[model samples]
Target: MPRARGSGASAAAGGGGAGAGHGGGGRLSGAGPGGQKSARGTALPACLSVSAGCRSSARACREGGGRGLGRAVLPWPPLVASVGAGGGGGTRGWADTESVGKKRCVCLLTGAWLNGVMGRRLGKNKGALNELFSKAAGMLACIIRESAALTRDVLEQHFNDLKGTLKKLLDERLMSLLQEVDAIEQESIKPLDECQKLIEHGVSTADDLLREGESAVHGDVGQQNEKLCIFTKKALHIQLDSLPEVPSLVDVPCLSAQLDDCLLTILKNQIFRHGTVASRPPVQLEEFVEKPGGILVRWCKVDEDFIPQDYRLQYRKGTATHFEDVYIGSETEFVVLHIDPNVDYQFRVCARRDGRQEWSPWSIPQIGSTTLVPHEWTTGLEGYSLSSRRNIALRNDAQSCGVLYSKAPTYFCGQTLTFRIETVGQPDRRDSLGVCVEQQNGCDSLQRDKAVCISTNGAVFVNGKEMTNQLPAVTSGSTVTFDMEVVHLGTSSNEGGNFKLRVTISSNNREVVFDWVLDQCCGSLYFGCSFSYPGWKVLVF
Candidate 1:
């Protein structure tokens, strides 16, 4: 028996070699007399066989002679088979074996070539792949970072907007609350403020009444004291009775709620309601005239049933806060004394009934002022007697024949001097009732050149010269009025302006007028009546 060759079994069998032909396996497997053949009727190729060992140089030579079946097994051309080979077993089998060996070598070379090419391509593309993946990762990281920043900014802006909105709402709410608080404060304090004002007014009025009573008592202890004491007591009693009652805390809410309405109602009641016999004040209190350092005030009651037992007069100087009182019993007119001259005064009056406790409201105020310069008598008139009270002037004797002048010169314009002659006894031509321009020296007389005089016998004289006209005749005990007016032709001055003396004399309803124009020497003048005999009586105003 032939020993089974390891790699050359099929080749040994196909070649019919003398040895066992299975020492080494060949590249292909072939059939033996008792060996199993492959299913395709072809020997297995050595390269495809799993049990085949690596080819050696000596076994290759042996297989190079046999015709193996590698050509049928593989798709490539048989590398070992020559075209010119004989069709004998030896040649054919050798060709088959060589072809199997060549096919195996080609497959190994192809595999190695594919592996080298793939390794070079993979080396070239390695950096590009790594760079693409790195850029994608960096882009993703950048996107994430930007997204986070945008989210943070959005959140911050949203928070800021929310904060501003909240602050504006809070500020508006705070302002509204402050305004409400102010309104509440004013409303709450209004009634208290009015009450405080009333208390202050009452205190001031009491102080004024006390001061007035003290002054009246101290000034005169007789009738003035008695009247002032009674008035003070009555006023105090009225104040006490009319005082507002203090409300308790329990009534605070109701009082505050109705404060204004209650006050208005009370005022209306006081003004319109007749609670007692005395209701309203004396109406139509008027200022009649200005006396010396005082004003005369008068009023009347229009109601027939209203009989006033006493009258209270209150006076105040211009814008003065306090008042001075003058209380009179059963009198409608009273003089507010000890006032300043040339100053304005306001006066109001109230009436008290005989048996009533309440006094009437004060009357409407009347305003008046004292004179700038009061009337007075002239001084040092020689040969004449002057009475300031009666406004009379009389000659000292029948033989008196001089000019009796006023102490102060009259205004050249806008002034009139009237003299009434009660008696012009013993009428003479030299007896005159007129005005004269006298010099400052005592020697200037009515007989001077700048004088105008009218005689009781209806004769007129100018500058000691007889005129052509005759005035109305004056008799004894017949009242005659002489009026003289001086007009300056230019600006008035004692030394420079021209003056005109207009004189009118009337007696028994008959009148006569005389006019004369004089020079600057007649500017400074005196008003008097010249008497040539005794028993001449005249009044000057």
Candidate 2:
């Protein structure tokens, strides 16, 4: 081995070291938290890396010394030991092992004086991530607030416009949606509230601990140990690795809003459609409004003199040839419930005669759709075609790259887009085989100038610039999901909320979450991804 100088740079540069040995201020290898050797301490290993530098950083990293924002796991390994263990670049005839050991010992002593000065700078980035997370939660709250308000205004304005057209009907539906909006806002903000309280309490506690430690340091020696105990216990309880889940768009999804506009428009044209009397059909599926769970269908009589004994409501599922009875009674308004979200359903109504007479004819078929938006991939590149109602994207040309983009009903707050890797044609042909983003569907590759993506090697790139966050690479047959929500609205007053999604990508059960904020404003965002090689099929939802 070469007798490299104890340059202090070799051991502390990275935190992937195996161990550290006796250097300056070095106690036993297994020193306790009190900086004292343990009763059963084992001797430190002799073979240490010669290239290690800056012992203070390395020591801080190993000890997890600093306290800020909150505690977190060391992203990499410890840096104190295993510097030149593999030996410097040279062929070694190990005839004089003792001499080499002696030289390494001398180098350790030379680097010992840098104990406090060097390693303190080690792993300076430890707590930065947690700090950013806390701050981002705050910022995201602001964005959600603005977006929710805008959404409320939009909804209110539409109903208010219809106030004169159908006062009773409009008012009832408007009030229901408004109430629901309030509930959604409250539920979404609940976790944020709890998180805020916890952070504030922690800050106050940390302040108290700091003051107590400072005073104790300056005052009585006997009190220091007690303070340490309190500090250690308190610090250990501040959990990391996860954040409280705040409500987003996907939680407790209900039937999506589907309006039978054609039917409603016809009803609106008839000035005398609503009356106490009945017609051939006896009832009309006149108006329908969206409820959180399903649509509310309302009908009325056509003539004041004619009366019906009772009414009946029936519905048919998507694309079926026959209609099934759902509700049967005299009620004019019925709330359809327990239906699949986002799917199309047909509803019809009729009435029975007054005196044990036969039932009236079925009303015109009214088409209604649910409100809940299912995950889907709408568009893709030339070599890719969408199947399963645009929910799956298949790459037919294995020789070329495949790219796909998600459609509307974009990821709102707390919504997730998942991709099942049904076919891993040739992941080895490309550096990235899974999810990515592009400015628009026009981009041919994920490495575009406006794209934000992670390479298969786990490097993050934004507009071609590499970032500090190193995500995990994807594997074959892995399920890749992207959870996105609105984090900010555009600067303009009328512009819709811009999406800067905080992403967490996981595959094969190894998940790592990191924030990759995309700066684009389109109210809703289109998710895009590109695969370098072909023969890959993705089922998106």
Model number with the top TM-score? 1
- Cα lDDT of model 2 by residue, 181-256, tens digit: 7887788677778987877776777787777667756766898888777767766775533455555677744434
lDDT of 1 by residue, 450-490 (tens): 76666767676777788776766666555554444554455
User: What is the Cα-based TM-score of model 2?
Assistant: 0.29
Cα lDDT, model 2, residue 356 = 63
TM-scores, in order shown? 0.30, 0.29
What is the model-wide C-alpha lDDT for candidate 2? 0.46
lDDT by candidate, in order shown = 0.48, 0.46
